[model samples]
Target chain A: MLEGILTGLSTATMPVNLFMVFIGCFVGTFIGMLPGLGPISAIALMIPITYGLDPASGIILMAGVYYGAIFGGSTSSILINAPGCSGTVVTAFDGYPLAQKGQAGKALALAAYASFTGGTISAVFLLVAAPALASVSLSFQSADYFALMVLGLSAVAAFSGKGNILKALMMTVLGLMISTIGTDRSSGVDRFTFGRMDLVDGISFLLLAMATFALAEALMSVLKPEDNGEADEDAMRNLGSMKLNKEEIKEVAPVIARSSVLGFFVGVLPGAGATIAAFLAYGFERNLAKAKEKLKFGLGSLKGLAAPEAANNAASSGSFVPLLTLGIPGSGTTAIMLGALISYGIQPGPRLFLDNPEVFWSVIISMYVGNIVLLILNLPLIPYISRLLAVPRQVLVPMILLFSITGVYLVSFNSADILIMVIITVLAIVLRLLDFPLAPLLLGFILGGMLEDNLRRALLISDGGYSFIWERPITLTIFCITLFVLVAPLASGMWKKYRKKTVGYGASMQE
Target chain B: MTISRDQIAGLVFLVFSLAYGFYATDIALLPGEEFEPINARTMPYVLSGLGAALSFFFVLASWRSAGTLKPLKLGLMAWPPVIALLVVMVIYGLILNWLGFVVSTALFLIAGFRIMGERRPKILFGVSIPFVAISWFCLTQLLDIYLAPGRLFSLLGG
Candidate 1:
């Protein structure tokens, strides 16, 4: 294990690989700085570029973008009250208020340091935990894997959007249905291609990603431009020193440490990602604080600045665990990363440790390098980086559209793919307009193939006995967990209503 | 006549699911595998049936919840720019071979910028031209991928 780690470090340090890391971070920061763009789109846009490179370099570059974008997301949150990504939404709650108080530099500094610390800590956890988990999963059978995939799909229904779990679950089912659109490998028979030659390969991952994230996002902005607030000139003038005083450091370090550990664990769960981690950390800190200190939350507390900033960055790293060990992506951005891995002909799973140790370790080590590169780039250059908010949407949106078109075209040099991209983009826009969550759709699509394969394999092993699922302890436990996750939300909602009603009755009695 | 977004979504998906389920039945099993418990068609049928049932439930839920409310409809003024952008993109995709990468991209950008309310033609031409040139150079030269020069470029003849 030590030798593998050292080998990964050496490979990541090579000149070409190191250069790709720098480029990924730089571009990722810019992408994250853009108001309407997020890490998912940034990663998607880079997929075509990574096509020609070696697997290690390709993944290193994409991973760099993932972390760099998170770091850059805090810049927009603090300066403009526009979190460049969803994960940075909680950061803006107090981050912007701090900027308004002439503490922009302090807020940004705390964010930078906290992000670095959290990321580095999470990477260490990943380095230790992923391998251990992978070895354990190596003992898993087909039944166990199918149950695990079911758990993953169910968790998406639990964690996505606030409106309706039923709606999310339906979208997931639709995604799975869409995944059935090509030739079945075992049967050599077409399933749902509808006789189109293009459908033989099923849908292209890049095309779907570009349409859903980049193109759909641009079109939505055009339909109704977001009211992204501008940075305050007065606050810009008081862009105070980036240095944290000793007192501030003493207060923030422990919060950063606590949130990093907390966020990493949250991120390790399927369907939960940075946004949940950030909110959890923020709430945890507020609840733990004394009354007077608690009042400072959402009102520019330094602890507020540190908690979510650290947690979200840590959570991004934490989300990598299941992707590496189980071959199931825990979030939307990681789903795209999983797609990139598969595109390179590398299968990610328990056997990845034995079959493709180089790909796994190098990506793991690149996170360490990426976090350092982001901290160094963001701390001093933050003031300038925030200026990206001022770029006109007319210019930025058009350029992004061009890149989406060209990137998809370059993958196969086929204009037919471009047409398919446009059609999908239109479908994505209609779905977004109706408030259908795209993340579940994407999660369903990515995991569906593996789910079907495992289901079939398990049944074959059992000679068509469905009892094998419950017969196996591992599979049974996973199904139980899935049932709990799905039911917990409904149970909690009812409990909250019950508590509210009882409290209301008590108040009426007193009156 | 006035359906909520959720209702429309549910109806569309429900119809889609039924079609998917019906079509999946036609997927033939591998030779001598007809008696197999799980085959290629099994997952698709199960998934589509579940999808159809869930979508039906969704439609009923939305209809029940939405007793009498509707979001303000988008005014006619809200759509031209978006429609124009989409149209320009379709045209651009159609013209790329005939007019080539540089020409079509430049034209698309100019139209796109104008439609988005960028009024200055100088700024429009300046940004669009340089962008197309640089991207063309990067993809064709640095990346060593070919972007067609177009029929127009061929007609011009060096």
Candidate 2:
């Protein structure tokens, strides 16, 4: 493990890799500061640029971007009360109130510190957890893999907000269906190409990612024009002394520590991502607070701010565990990363541990560096980066659209791809409007080929009896978990209802 | 009954799945492949069935659930510029083969800016021209990715 860490340190410290990380963080911060764009879109936009680099550097760059984007999201949340992504939505609860109280600097500084601590601790945990899980998953058979995929999909659907589960599952099915468009990998026969050569390779992951995330998000902003309101340009200029007194630090220190642990564990769950982690951590901290301090939660409580900031960053690191070890993405952003990794011809499963230890370890090491970079480099630049928010929507929107389409165009240089992207974007926008969760579709699409492949192998091993699922204890355990995940939402909803009736707006509803 | 957004999406997915299932049969299987445990059609068949069932339940879940079901809010959107932007994107795709990267991308950017209400010619050409030039230079010169000159240029040169 020490040797592997040294190897990772060497690769991560390489001039080019370090430069890529810097560039990724810079670009990611910029993109993420925008009100509408999220980390998934930010990473998707960067995917084209990473194609020119080696896999290790590429992944390192992406990891930096993921952290940068989250940090950047927190900045906007603090300065303007407009979170760049869902993960940072909770950051705004206390952060914006701090900004309003002329403590914007303190809030920003606290966020950076909390993020740094969370990222560092979770990186340590990931270092231990990822390899341990990798060693165990190394023994995963085709049946086990198929069951894991099922669990990943089910968990995603189950956690996709209260009413969105069915919609999310439908979108997952839709994504899986879309994945069958081109030639079947195992059979060497076309499935739904309809005699089109473009369909021969099916849809490129880049195109779908760009369309659904970057392009669709850009267009949806234009289409719907969400009124997130605006930030006071003057308030941003003077962020009011970015310093934390000893007492302030002492107060939030324990909160940050606790949230980091909570966030890491939640992130390790198959479908729970940073957004849920931040929300959970914030809720947890609020519950722990006394009545007076609890009242300050939505009104610039340092503990409230620190808790989510730490948890979200820690959860970001924890989410990588499933991606690195199990090859199942815990979140939508990682799903895009998984796609990019596969495109690099490097599958990110247990085999990745042996075949590309450098890629695995370097990512873990670089995450720590990424967190440090976010703190040292980005904290000071928040004032200037926030100024970028003033850039005319007219210019920025077009530029983003151009990047989104050009990203796909540069890859295949095919004109038809742009058309397909637009069509998909249209469909995606409609679905978005309909409130069908797009992440599951993306996750399902990414896992679609693998799921089918594993199922086929499992069936083949079982001689078409479907017994491989139940015969293997590991596979059965995973399938049982999947089933439990599917039923959990209904059961929880019922419990909540019963509790509400009996307890009369119980403590559960308070947080 | 007035259909909600959920019902609409469900119905559309249901139809799409049926069509997909119908087309799955047309996928040519090898002589002995069908007799095998799974073929190219098997996954598609399963997906189609799942999609149909899921969409069916989705429809049923929304059926008469009026309190929670959001009515489609299509009228709230500013459709003209969005539709115009879509047209601009499609046109950009069409013209790219003829005009190549620089010209088509410039036009796309210009149109996008314009649709989004940017009328200043200076800003339009200023951003698009320099941006395209740098991007083109980077791709062709620095990166060594060959982007052929537009068909019109090729024809004229010949």
Candidate 3:
């Protein structure tokens, strides 16, 4: 393990890799600070650009963008109460209040420190944990692999979105069907291409990503033109000292430490990401605070600001575990990263350690480098980064649209790809309007090919025996878990109703 | 009976699954692999079947529910503008090869900004021109990828 870490550090030290990380973080922070743009779109737009680079460089760049966005998001949340990213929404609850109280600098500094600490702690956990877990899966057979994939898809569908589980499952199935297009691998024949030559290669991951996330998000912004009503240019002054005194540090240190552990574990789970971690950490801290000081929480308490900041950053690192070790993404952003990895002809899974240890380790080491860089960029430069909030949607939207188009064209050099992207974008916008969560659809799309390939391979090993799904112990255990995950919510919902009815009946008899 | 959003979504998925299932049946198996336990058509068949069942479940869940769905509020700048923007994007994609990156991007941005209510011509050109120019230079020079220089440039014999 130590040797692998050293090897990774050396790989990450390459000048090109280092430069990509810096540039990615800088650009990611700049774009991610915009009100409507987030880490996903920022990384999505960069995917085409990274096509010209090596796999390690591309992965490094994307990781930097992910971390940078988390850092940049806190700036807007603190200064203007508008979270630049979804994960930062919890930060804005108390961060903006601190800014209102003339401690914008203090709030921003606390966020930078907490984010750095949480991220680094999680990075340590990832370094120690992912390899150990991957080693266990190294012995997994095809049946076990297929069962694990099913478990992953089920967890994501059940937990990621707050909407109806049936809808998420339907979307997951739809994504699986979409993956079946083009050629049937086993038969060596086209299945659903409908005679279009381009469909022979199946749909490009770039097109699906851009259409669902970047262009769809851009089109939705155009349609709604969400009122950026919270940005108050007048309150942008008096960013008091960025330095946190010893006493203030003492107050937030434990909160950051506790939340880092909580956030990292939640992140390791499929379907739970930084957004949930942040909210959970914040609520936990609120409950921990004293009654007299509790009221100060949402009104500018430093502890309130630190908890979510720490958790969200930690959660981002935690989410990488499943993607790297299991080849299953825990969240939407990581799902995009999984797609990026596959585009480079690198399949991420348990064998990733043995097959591409350099890529795995370098990516892990780069997180340490990226977090330190983010802390440096965020501390003193935050005041200026906040000015980015003033950029209007009208100006930003068209530019994003142009970038998406140009980027897609540059990747394929085919005009048809761009048209397809636009069409998919329109369809995605309609889906979004109807409140169908797009993330699960994306996760499904990414995992579908692997799921089918493994399922078939497992059956081939069994000589067409269908009973291996439950006959193999490991596979059976995973299937049982998937089954429990699917039914748990309904079971719990019914249990609560039954308890409530029984209690009501008992009370009436007493009366 | 009025359909809710979930019902509409369910219907869409149901129709798509039925169509997909029908298509899966016609996919031919590989030679000598006809009796194979698991073949190319297996997963798609399973997924389509699952999709049909799930969508039916969704429709049933939505059907027995009793709450008012949120009214679709197409605010001030609504459907017409959105539809118009989509048309503009489609046109931009169509002319991109002919008009070149610079010209097409410029025209798209100008039209897009105008439709989104950017009335200031100065700010419009100021942002659009520099962005288009820099991105073109980076793609062509830095990345060594070619963007179509357009018919006008070709006609000028550059």
TM-score: which candidate is best?
A: 2
DockQ of each: 0.62, 0.81, 0.69
Write candidate 3's Cα lDDT for A302-355 as tens digits.
999999999999999999998899888888899899999999999999989889
Give the per-residue lDDT digits (tens) of candidate 1, residues A194-293: 8888888888878888999988887777887666533465565568878899999999999999999999999999988899999999999999888999
Q: TM for chain B in all models?
A: 0.84, 0.93, 0.86
lDDT by residue for model 2 (A198-274), tens? 88999998999999999888888788775544344656888999999999999999999999999999999989989
The C-alpha stretches of model 2 lying farther than 4 A from their native spots are: A226-231, A495-511, B70-72
lDDT of 2: 0.90
- Model 3 clash tally? 0
Which ten contiguous residues of candidate 3 chain B have the minimum total lDDT? Answer: B66-75
Interface Cα RMSD for all candidates? 1.9, 1.0, 1.7
Local error of candidate 1 at B26, Å? 3.5
**CAPRI-style grade of the A/B interface in model 1:** medium
- Model 3, stretches more than 4 Å misplaced? A504-511, B75-77, B151-158
Considering lDDT, where higher is better, how would the candidates rank from best to worst?
Answer: 2, 1, 3
**lDDT (tens digit, per residue) of candidate 2 on B1-158:** 68777777899999999999999999999889989898899999999999999889889878847457555678998888888988898998999999888888888998899999999999889988999899999998998898878999999989
Distance (Å) between predicted and true CA of B157, model 2?
A: 2.1
